[model samples]
Structures are given as C-alpha cells and as structure tokens.
Target: MDMDGGWCSLEEIGPLSKLRRLTLHGLEDVSASSLAETARISSKEHLEYLELHWSSSGCMELRDEIEKQQQQEVVEEVLEKLCPPPRIHELHIKGYFGRTLPNWMMVVEACACKSLSILCLAYLPCCTKLADGLCRLPSLERLVIADAPAIKSIGSEFQASSSSSTVDGGVTESTSAAFPNLKYLSLVGLCEWEDWEWEEQTVDVTAGAMAMHALERLEIMKGKLSCLPPGLANNKRHALRELNLVELSNLTSVENFPSIVELIVCDCPKLKRISGLSRLHKIGIGRCPSVEVLQGVPSLHSIELEDGTIERLPGYLPCVNPKFLKLTCSKELHGSIISGSSSEWEKISHITKVVIYDIEDSDEG
Candidate 1:
C-alpha cells in the first residue's frame, strides 16, 4: 500500500511480519521520522534483502550547505528508525546524498546487519566516509562502492578499531580483523580520492588484526589512488589471487601482492613499475607505456601486451619469463620485429608461442 509519500504510509507494512524482501523507492519524498518506527522493520526477521533509494535529483550537487545538513539529519533519523534485522544478508543503498550514514550502519557494537554477506553502495555522491563498522562484518563476502566522487581519503575508520581491556593481570585483549570473510571487492569511479591512511597502531596487525585476510580478488580503477593503502599491502594472509588496476589516473606502481596469479593493467598512464610477485603466471597490459620495470615473477607463463604507439619492443620484454607472448603494436613496430636487423625476435626467442598484431591488420580483421 502506498500513500502520498509519507513515512506514516508505511504503517500498513508494519504488521506484515513475514515480508521476506522490501524495496522502498523515493525515500527522499518521506518525512516524519517518528512514524518510521511504527513500521516495525526490526520485527521483520525473515527479511533478507533490502533496498533504500532516494530520488536522483539531489545527488549531483548540493544546493547549499544548510539545506544539505538539514536533509542529512532527516534522512539519518528516518534510516535509524527503519533499521534492518541483525542477520539480514544483503543491503543496497543508492542515491544517498547524506554526508554521513546513519548510526545503525556505522557504530560497530550496534550495527544493523551483523550477518550481511553482500553489500553494495552506489551513486553516493555526498558521502565522505564509508560506514565505519563495515570491517566488523564477519560474513560479508562481496562489497562494492561505486561512483562516489567527493571522498578525498579512506582513513583508518575503514578498519575495525581494537578495544583494549586489562584484567587483574597486564594482559591486553584483542579484536578480530577487518573484512575477515571478504573475497571479492571493487572500488570504481571514485574520481576525487587522494589518500588511503591506514596507520599501523599498537593493536593493529601485530595481534592478528590483518584486514581483508580472506580477500581473493580486488579491483581498483578510475580513481586518484597514487598508492595502495597499508591495510592491503600489510595483509599477512597473502590470500589475494587476482589484482586488476585500470584507468587509475595517478597510480605509479603495482607490486607486493605475493599470492596474485593473474594481473591486469590497462590505461594507467603513469604506472611505471610492476615487480615482487613470486607466484604470478599471466599478465595482460594495454596502453600503459610508462612501465619501465617488470621483474621478479619467475613463474609467469603468458604475456598479452597492447601498445599502438611504440616503434620497438618494450625494454621490459627481455626481463619477463613468460613462454607465450601476444602483442599488439603499430605497423612500424611490427615491421621492426619482423626485420632481421631488429633484436625483437632475438629477445623473444625463448617464448614457445608468439602472436603479433599491427593496427592496420587489426582494423582489417
């Protein structure tokens, strides 16, 4: 039942205790947070999936600071009242313009969905920080944050803070790691992000507080991320298997993910170095010409390189251990590789399979 865009209208849904899934659209049109509590969302224990969406009008840019703050307060209050059950599996929030998320999603001890497994936050243009308690979720496996442009930094708030307790003895207590069950993660179109400050503290990592310990695949693309956060690099679990870096405008290097089996790098113009992965096997690279150092992977088997501007093979080719090479290049570069005078063939003689494509040949085929 829908009634004229008011939270009081949701009261009819309150007693529908068996509701398994709910999608509330036009959340921005609602007022009267006090009425939201009467909907009794907390009582819907069978509810597993929830979507809260606001209108797209306010997400592009704020009209003014005062109006933004007022809207944030009202939305937060409404969300606080509409908290999901503790064991809800999936929560998706889209088109949220609020600067901060509601307390039900932030505060660790009181987080709304402790059993959340798949969480997606998209088009959150005004949020500066991610939910602080995201790290505390033990069951979350897939998490994605997309198209948030205002965020400048990802601070230690993304990590689970350690709590200290002293018993009769001087022994200290320990907290669990962040993103313990996270396997697949993606961060896309965060255009304004600049810093990732995960400062190692007295209780961080040494007491087995490594975050994303179970993460297997990570994708970071289309951001100002110059470097990976320490939280990722310092993970002792070495469980990450696939690393994808694409279109990152300022990223300069890719290294130190020891367990990675396949690495993909494309359109990252400023990236210069890739090294120090002992288990790497396959690599795909496209339009990333500044990469001058590619070394330290003895187990590599295949290399797919695409560059249309080069007149000669890249200097790093002689250092790679891949037995199969597939290359795309300019016609002049292809001519140089075929010419007996060029060292290109001599450089790749050890490869068991080699395929080449020039721009003209590619266009015809």
Candidate 2:
C-alpha cells in the first residue's frame, strides 16, 4: 500500500498483520519515535518486503538535532524498536543520510529473514560502513548501491581490519572468510571515486580470487575506473560471464576475459583497442572515438560499432563470422560507400547480415 507524505499512526498498522509487503515513501512527518512505536505493535509477522524513502524536507527540519551525538543515539534506539523482525526478505532504503547504519541494519541478527536475498541502498550520503555490514548477510545474492558519493572505498576496511590483526598476531582462520555467497554487484553514479585502488587494507589477490570464483556478473557504470581491479585480472580463469563498462571516460584498455560471452563498452571515448576477448559471442561498442580494431575474439556472432575514429575496418574483421553485424560511421565514409572504393566496404560482404548506415541517416531516420 502507498503511504507517502502521510501520518501513519503506530496503532493503525497493528491490524494489518497479514500484509506481505509495505512501502513508506517520502515519509515527511513520520518521526523516528512513532516509527519505532509502530514496529513494536505491528503484527505483520509475514511481511516479506519493506521499502523506506526518507523525505528531504524531513531531514532538513531535524538537521541540527540529527547532527548531535545524543540525538543520533535516540534515532538508533527508535529505529531498533521500529524494525520488524528479519521476516522482510527485500529491504530498500532511499535518501537515508544518517552517518552510520541504522541500528536495525545489523547484518548478524537482521539476516534472520530466511528469504532475504536483495538489498538496495540509494542516495545514502553517509554510508561508509554499510558495505561491511552488508557482506555479513548470509543469504544476500544481489546488491545495488547508487549515488552514494561519500562511499570512498568498499571491501577496503574489511581488508584493513584483517591486516591490523595479522600485524598484531591476532589473525585466526576465522578471519579469512567474508561474503562467501555474493554473486552479483552493481555500482553506479559514484562520481567522486577515481579508481578502485589496491591499498594495504584492500582485499588480497587470493581473497579477490575467491570472490571472483563465485561472481558471475559485474556492471560498473559512470565511474572513473582506469583499469580492472588486480584481483579480477589475476583470477581471470573464474566463472564470470558478462562485463559491462558504461560512460567510464578514463578507461582505456580491457584485460582479458576468456570466459565472458557478452562485452558492452559504451561512451568510453578514449578506448582505442580491445584485446583478449576470445570467448566473446556478443559485443556492443558505441561512441568510442579511438577504437580502431576488433581483435582476439574468434567466436563473436553479434557485433555493433558506432561513432569510431577508424576510417576502415580493423585488420581483425575477416576473422569474425558474425551473424548480425551493424556499423554506423562518419558521413565521409558514406561517400566512399556510394563510390564503391572504400576498402572497409569490401569486408562487409563477409558478415552474414551486414547493415551499414551513415551516422546522419542512422540518427535522423
């Protein structure tokens, strides 16, 4: 049920014990105390999903109070009282800017929701330790974090915490395990991140190797990633099947992906070449100014190229037996196609379903 910008009394939700899903969006007037009171009385023991969207206006009104340490403690205590027992499998929080995780977000006890699988946090301004707590969720399979500009690093603190123990001779066999079941991860719109640097506290190659062994898909969109994380590179032999790099302006090269079946590179203007994609079957390359070659993939069946700098097809085209080939190049290249002398045009006949349209026509019609 939709409850947006409305006063939902704690006493009103107690009768809806059979409700399976609830959304409290843009809760402008709901205070932490009232929310906690509702949680204490709500009989929705079967609730499987909950979404909370904090109001920007509400946060502004309590900004000063929330900043005080005592106020923060009060807020956490209220949240703990309000949090439903771990019966909610999917939890999504948006616009939650608290400096630390809400007390209800502790993974060890909150993950008791046997069906919990997906957790999404969006537009959270102060979630430095959220990732660490999230990794402890035993059944978590998919996680999406968007617009969290303040999250400077992930998997870094845990690595650091472990290292401190080793240096102090406190390391134990139990310390090596973390996030063993996570399979899909997506990060987007983290504008301040320059790179995924491997600091001393970052996960070691071996740990990364173990993580990659279980990971099957990764999408990094709109970040400043200059290179692949070293752990993924070192463990290239893992089971990853799909890789997507979108609008990452600083990325210039791609490391090998021998098992990947799909690779999409879009809006990476500086990307000039792609290498070591031998198992790729589908490729989409668009808006790249420097790309000139399609090399190292013998099994490609679908190919797309648009807005590139190369005047002719790269030397590797003849080797690809693509079933669906699409190419859109400069208007100048169109004249060569009409005149029938472009060497690039010669290679099109080899592709089974070749479709070439000038950039202008492709855009207008």
Candidate 3:
C-alpha cells in the first residue's frame, strides 16, 4: 500500500484480510470509487504479491494524442479497478499508461492466478501486447519484460490455452504450453523488441514439445532482437542452460543452443555465428566483431575473451583440458599470446589456467 498521490482511501484499508504483500505507487490521485476499493482489496485469498505503479511524472504531462488517449483511458480505469489476487503469486506492472489490459489480465482461468510464479511487465509505454492473458499462465516460472518501448511483437498470442481431458470416460484434448514452467527468462530494456514469432500452427507436436520445456536461464539485454523464439532457434532448445546475449544490435544469429552450458556474447556487433553450442562448459566473448567462427563447442572448459577481437584459437580442445583461459587482449594480442606465435602456444596448450591480460593492463588493473 504505497500510494503517494493522495494518501488514504483505498476504502481506508479496513479489511486487509491477511494481506500478503502489495504495492500501489503514486497513482496520480487515485479515485474511481477508490480504484474500486483497490479492486476489492485484490480479491484477497491471502494476496501473494502484486505491484502496480503509475505516474511516470504524471505520464510526462500527456503530450496530447488526444491527451494521451485520455490518459490511456484513465490508466485503463485504474488497471481495471486494480484486480489481481486469485492467489496472486507475483505480478508487477510498472509505470503503466495502459494501451490495454483488463479482462482479468487475459484470463488465467479467469484470474484464479493458478499460483502465478512471476510476471514482471515493466515501464509500459503504451503496452502493445503482453498481458493480454499472458500466454494463459500455467504457473509461469519467471518472466521479465522491461522498459517496454512499444513492444514490436511476441505474437502467436503467446500460446498456452487448449485444455480438456478425461479419457477412458472420454473427453481428451489436453494441449497447451507457453512458459510451461518457464525458468528464468529476462528481456531487458526493450528498445522496440523486434520479434518473438511463435505460432507454428498454434501448437501441437505435443504442444510444441511442451513449449520451451522448462527453460533454464536465458537473458537478452538492450533488445531489438532480430531473432530468437523459434524455440530458441536451431535444434530447438530443450532446457536452455545459461545463455546471455547483450547489446543485441539486431542480433544476427548464434545458431543452435543444444542445452547450452554457460555462454555469453556481449556487444553483439551483428553477430554472425557461434556454431551449434555443443554443451559449452563456459565461454565468454565480448565486443563481438561479427564472430567469425568458434567451431562446435565440445563442452569447452573455460574461455573468456574480451576486445582484441579474438585473433585466433578454437581449433578443437574440450576433451576436458582447458580449466580457464581469460584473454583481455591487445598489445598486439598480448604479443600473440606470449610468444608472437608457436601456434599460439599450441593453441592454448591444454590450458589449466592462462590469463593473458593487458588492454592497458586490463584498464590499469
């Protein structure tokens, strides 16, 4: 309960009824029957977690688009009277200027909440989509869509819907999976998120392999993503195991991610290719210079190259040798890795720990 605009009058608190966490920010002077009694105190079934914020400085003084669609219909009528609490598990809707949302946030069994796992839809500018029943929530594990810059697309209605089963007494129809137990997925600072297709015949094929079957750690930063979500492209990820792509400059491609095992690609400069990640053990490539090549990672032990634009390396290794090789790069690639070249010390000679620094001694250490 954090309304800064006009303190008090969510029907004056009263029956918190064992409230279990709630945050309502500077609601630009709430009132629509006190936001419908704060949506009936969030339909308390012992509320689980709900955050609703408004007033991005009173929506930057609504620079007229008919007064910002009349303050986006009064912030979608106070987020449809601030409803959400059918056992809400976690829901955060920040700085809303609602373009749409209501209808119990797109029917999670009509806002039963199904114990929602975590859903954060941040700084909505004019919410283009998302929150339209958010893939029908089946215990969403973790989802973060930040700083919405007028979403570009996450189409296919974000899947998850078909339900009906009874077999043996006859009924059968079960097929729905979208964020089906999602596991840590973050998309930050969406600068007009490019696309996230998903609509391959409205799921089937066992609901498209139960959709991202329990995804395991995936992060995309500063987005404008050019690709991703063909079930995480190439070989369709099974249980993504840690993958990070930063500064997505209209990402080009990183091909397969067959159960990735720790991989980071930063400052994607029109990413070219990183080949089929064959269970990488740990690899970090920064300021990518259109990644020329890095054969099929064979459970690579460890490698962290930043800058210098990878002069050379990655011929085979990964038969369990390398334990760590962090190259900061350039003083002529640290003098071609120590001795100008001897096949770069036979290509990092079975590395058990090689940290070639310098790039101004790694920024003056």
RMSD of each: 3.3, 4.9, 15.6
Q: Which stretches of candidate 1 lie over 4 Å from their true place?
A: 1-9, 59-65, 110-112, 161-164, 167-173, 199-208, 338-341, 359-365
Off by over 4 Å in 2: 1-7, 14-16, 33-37, 41-44, 57-84, 103-114, 126-130, 157-171, 174-177, 197-209, 234-237, 292-294, 308-323, 346-350
Local error of candidate 2 at residue 185 (angstroms): 2.2
Worst 10 residues of 1 by lDDT: 200-209
Candidate 3 lDDT, 20-75, residue by residue in tens:
87777766566453555544766677888878777766666766678767667777
Better by TM-score, candidate 3 or 2: 2
Put down candidate 1 lDDT per residue, 136-197, tens digits, no spaces: 77789999999888888888768654244676678765456677789999998888888988
Better structure of 1 and 2 per lDDT: 1
As for TM-score, the candidate ahead, 1 or 2, is: 1
TM-score of each: 0.89, 0.77, 0.37
Which 10-residue span in candidate 2 carries the lowest summed lDDT?
Answer: 157-166
Best by lDDT: 1
Worst 10 residues of 3 by lDDT: 199-208
Per-residue lDDT over 168-243 for candidate 2, one digit per residue giving the tens place of the 0 to 100 score: 4665433433445557877887765565743322334444424434567878888776777654544334567788
What is the C-alpha local distance difference test score of each model? Answer: 0.80, 0.65, 0.72
